[model samples]
Target: MKSSPQLPPGTCDCHTHVFLDEAKFPLWAARRYTPPPASIEALTALHDRLGVERVVIVQPSVYGSDNAATLHALRTLGQGRARGVAVIDDHTSDAELAAMADAGIRGVRVNLEVDGERDAQKATQWLRRTVERVAPLGWHVQLYASLSLLGACADMLGSLPVPLVFDHYAGAQAQLGLQQEGLAEVLKLVESGCAYVKLSAPYRCASPDALQSQEPLTRLLIDRNPDRMLWGSDWPHPQPGARPNASDVCPPFEVDLGKTLNALASWAPDAATLRKILVDNPRRLYGFDA
Candidate 1:
């Protein structure tokens, strides 16, 4: 295996998920995909090897809205280096939100592409409420939805006092291409400063017929909004429909981590820009300490 990329000082993996043992944290009964087991210890080792200094653990949909696993990992990795994004419902109490904030959780995630309708209205309401409660604490709302859904949310998002972080290049893909009308609206949001985007999942956004064709689209977004850009690993990747297998057996779909890190630098064309994507941007957005 190739050695992990040696990140610059203060580097951060801005987006990723940790799937724990189901014997302990049972998978959601309604999960759309079965994720392979992943752990904080394993992630720490990955980070150590990669030379990444910080990370933001986004709660996966397979766990529904339960954030206990994410919270516990944040507590254990107490270098003041890790933060988290959680999924919550409207019924989540003010105290619970505050507790999460104290536990290095600086954001809440609302996922859109799950197998079934997962209560978008309630999730939006929860985000609205949580944003109000966490405003004093400087937290943001991390949104995991397609470009179309994000376009719909753009107007409503401006009313929130916190920042909105978009995942997976705002879910634009080569198949949709630039002609994807919804992405134009997204670019406007990024331009208006209401949105931040992660340059993760370039593979997901690539055309199933041709992966190399994705570069132009990814580079376009990077050029358009370098300051608001971020990078992620999406580690222990949960490929849809495939049976879950060990990393050694399945090997994370064979993308080159070192090359991915290099691509971020190439896209932005500056060391400081890449650092901001890897470090400062995520730290400020997720409230990780320096």
Candidate 2:
């Protein structure tokens, strides 16, 4: 139980999820892979142990637009201690959106990568439309898209009605290194303060020497704009995943979260920068009380 690399006070794990009772919050038929029960109780204990004071429960792609599970987690955690980012379809009503806002949801997620959708044009369209939909709620749009898709549409970032939140390094390809096309654009977006990037799931984009390779990647964002950065455990980190029709389950990745925080400290320019990433930024982005 080494939660060594101490987390700062008011530190928020900005990107995490909890998959509770499937009977009540069933998975979508079109989902890629089944996830094991990663409940709020487990999440709370883990956060408590790690010294993280606040959390943001992001809607996992497996649930599609059904946010019951995410909302449940937020309620169980209680306000001031937790907030959420939900997933919604065109069918979701304004009343429902308003209800979610009241329940402490601060954002909506647009996950293009999970659907295996490679159409950069379509991805950009979805993002723009999602921004329009959630804009009225004053919620930022969180995107989980590939760097290639992202690279093709960086020009569109400046014109969005709402702020953008990039998940998992904005789909940067660790192996691609300098060849990661959207990397520069993402850096610029952070620099311009039009978007926020989560320094999360480094293992997802890891190269052979993952630790060494991930350093520069995380550092680049920290260096460009620490104010716009967020750090998340991406807890219960699921494997890459299988087809929509696949019957098998995707087990989570094993990570030493405390050590990962330490690594983030190394990437950030200073202690205050780390605090900005872990505390100040998430509070402002999610509307947590001071």
Candidate 3:
């Protein structure tokens, strides 16, 4: 394994996942992918070695609504240094939400892909209710949804009391170029200042699957709003079960962590601007110490 790169002081990794150790919590039957062991101890050491001062443990889709692993990871990391985004359903009670707040979970994830909408209306209603429930805790709603639905949900998102965060560069179609309507809608969201967007996962968003091609959209998003943007390493990328091609079995491409840091220059401000992405912005969004 590569030695973790040293991060700037006060840096924060705003996106990373924690998977339940099978020995402790067995896999969910509906999980679409099997994640490798990503324990709290392992994650902390990654931060220490990388020089990241804080982290946000986002709930991976593999766990669905089972946030025990995420919560446990938070407890292990302790308050001030760590926070989390949980997967939740409409039936998640207020007490449960309150307890999550206490446990340093400042966000909830709505995984539209896994939740598959037989009826889009029903799914929308469920999501709306969830947003209302967590509003009091000052928690943002983290979305992993199709870009096509962004405009349709714009009105609903504006009604939300807390900020909304979109993952994977707003799931844009890299082949279609930035003119893609989905990317435009994402820009509109940021233009209005109602949402925060992650500049992580360029590898997941690029055309021909090249990180360099992703810089244009990254530039656009940062240009739109520097304050609301953040960056992360989707650490230990779960190797896709089915190979896209021959390279599937080969070693995956290295995440150019510095490229993300340097994107602050192309997209928005300089390293100081990048500093907010690593430090202040997350502290405000996830309630970590500044």
Candidate 4:
């Protein structure tokens, strides 16, 4: 087996998901795809093997707005080692939000991909309301949307009251390289100090050859703002239609975790910059204590 990369102390995998006992935390009936249960025990083992000391458990789309699984995972992985980003709507009560804040939820996720195309007016309204709700708590908004939608919402995104985190390379389309529509807007956000982006799931956005094409874009983003960058494994990659059966517990899907880590490492100008991306940046954004 290829050896895991040696990461700095307090290195954080800023993005991951844990799907525990299905009977206890069932998938949303309207979910676009079903994922195999990736229990907290399995995630911990992966982290230990990868030499990752901290993590951020993001609420996956399959669970919709029900953050029970994400909350349970965070409590189980306590000791200030794990934080969470929940999926919530305008109806979510202030009491529930306060409770989640105490439980280590530091942000709210707005995933536009789940329902596909949406009316621009309604989407903007939802974004505004959600941001207003989370801003006072000093929480950020983690956005998972398509490039087109990102472009459409760029102005509002830049104006939000809290920090913005764009997921999966800002949903850039691989085939277009740096010329991808909406990418410039995202880069501008980073340049203006209005946003952060996750260097993760390259496979989701780029093909093997296209992955090489991403080098320039990756380097540019790192150079533009290393402090605004974060890394994640996107573990157990849940592809569309990948449903898990309750009868069998299969081996986890195969992904070259080491390779992903190395690719992100290559973009760093030096050891210090790498530490900033893997450790310092996450600490600041996720509010991890020194």
Candidate 5:
């Protein structure tokens, strides 16, 4: 096995999650799949092996808007080493938001793809509402949707007061490279500093043979603006399994995150840029100390 890269000090895995103790923190009834016990210990071990020092534990869709499990993990890891992105709704209280902010929650997640939502109108509405709520708190809205949906809502992006974050390389079409449908809009956001992208979870999106395109995709992103790029282990690497309301619990993908970081090493043009993705960019975005 190839060893993981020795990342710079203060390197942060910009995205990851922890799901454990189901009796205390049950999965959402409407979730598409049941994830295994991705507890904080497992996450810490994975990051330690990968040479990552900090993490952003994003609230998985299975947890819905509860934010409890994610917040618990963030609190366990503590604000200094961990930050979070929660899932909230209109009914979420300002008190709760303040508590989350204190717990180091820097953003909110809108994972429409997990909901199998394709309508851009609904997505646009979601975007508007979520962004408006989080804007005053200086938090960004992190999104996961089809590229088509992104393009449909791209026009309104500039008016938002806070930065937007698109995870998983903004839904790369591996065979399509920069020509991926709707990529132009997302790339423009990255270039103009209106948005950020997380280089995570390629195994969830592309076939192995087509993984070559990630290099060019990363190159284009860097050429546009390296400062907006981030890298993540996406630890335990959850994949959608049998639909929710089913009896099956899907085990997480056995991704060697060391390899994932190595892939990132190749994507970046040099040592300086890789440090930006693994360290500086996350510090700026997640409000981590320098």
Candidate 6:
């Protein structure tokens, strides 16, 4: 068998999803896309091969507010090595939230891009209420909104009681380059320790060339607040639909773990910084013990 890339002990993949046994955990009827099953076993093997010791299973939009699949995966992966981010609405009860916390879920996700303006008002209300509910649990809010939406919600996001984690570079458009709308506000959040940005799935937001070209932005974020940064594989990369207004489509779903690691290594100036990105930052964010 091929060897996994060497990484610091306690390295964590801060974002990933486990779509398993759809028969048991069916997709939401209103889901935008149906992804192939990427089971717990597959995720474990992938993480093991990447030399990652811990993972965070983000609840995909396909499951809507039903986090059974994510919760099940967390249990299968074992609480000691796994944490989760779930999707919830105001209808979710405190007992349910308590159960999720016991099952290793430490955060909630809000996908504005998927919800759209038709539901925007309700989604915003849900977000505010959810934030209030989870604040007492010491849980962060994970968001998958576009740059424009992010900029529009900047003030409210900045005022969130818990930490805010922006998934996939806050969905910045590659064609826009460093001048991407709302990026400046995102940088401010990072600078102020009010947010975290995951350096994951560059393909989702930027073409390979654009990603390479935007090294300065990446470096600026890292340099500005290394402590508020995190990394993830976005493994079994889910393709919900064609990116809106993006001239280039995302590459194939296959994730090259080594290449991802190499890119991260290239972005970091030294081993210590790399360790922080791979280990320390995630440890702090996800409550992974040293």
TM-score of each: 0.87, 0.95, 0.87, 0.93, 0.95, 0.91
Query: Model 4: per-residue lDDT, tens digit, 9-90?
Result: 9999988998788899988877766677788998889889888999999999878889999999989999489999999976
TM-score of 5: 0.95
Cα lDDT tens digits for candidate 6, 59-173: 9988889999999999888878999999998789999999999999999998887755434355567679879899999999998888777776777788888999999877776
The CA lDDT at 142 in model 1 is 80
lDDT of 2 by residue, 1-290 (tens): 43557778899999999888878898888877888889898999998888899999999988889999999898898987999999988899889999999999999988888777888778777787788778988999998988877767778976787888999988886778755777888788889999899889888888423655788788877888889999888988877463344456777777878778778887788889888998999999999988
lDDT of 1 by residue, 133-177 (tens): 667767777877777766666677767788888888888877776
How far is 286's C-alpha from truth in model 1 (Å)?
1.7
Off by over 4 Å in 1: 1-6, 115-136, 207-211, 243-252
**1-290 in candidate 3: lDDT tens per residue?**
34433456777788898766677876666666566676777778767766788888898876768788888888988886888999887677888988999999998888775454444476578678777788888889888776777656766766777799988777775666878766676787888888888877777776323656776777778778878888777765554444444222323345655555454445555767776677778878888765
Q: What is candidate 4's TM-score against the reference?
A: 0.93
Residue 110 in model 5: lDDT:
93
Model 2 weakest lDDT span, ten residues long: 239-248
Off by over 4 Å in 6: 1-5, 116-124, 208-211, 242-252
Model 6: worst 10 consecutive residues (lDDT sum): 243-252
- Candidate 3 residues lying further than 4 Å off, grouped into runs, are 1-6, 115-123, 207-209, 239-268
Worst lDDT window (10 residues) for model 5?
204-213
Candidate lDDT scores, in order, read 0.76, 0.85, 0.73, 0.83, 0.84, 0.82
lDDT for each residue of candidate 5 in 5-32, tens digit (9 for 90 to 100): 8889999988888888999998888777
Clashing pairs in 1: none
- How big is the positional error of residue 168 in model 6, measured in Å on the Cα after superposition? 0.3
Off by over 4 Å in 2: 207-209, 242-245
Q: How many backbone clashes does candidate 4 have?
A: 0
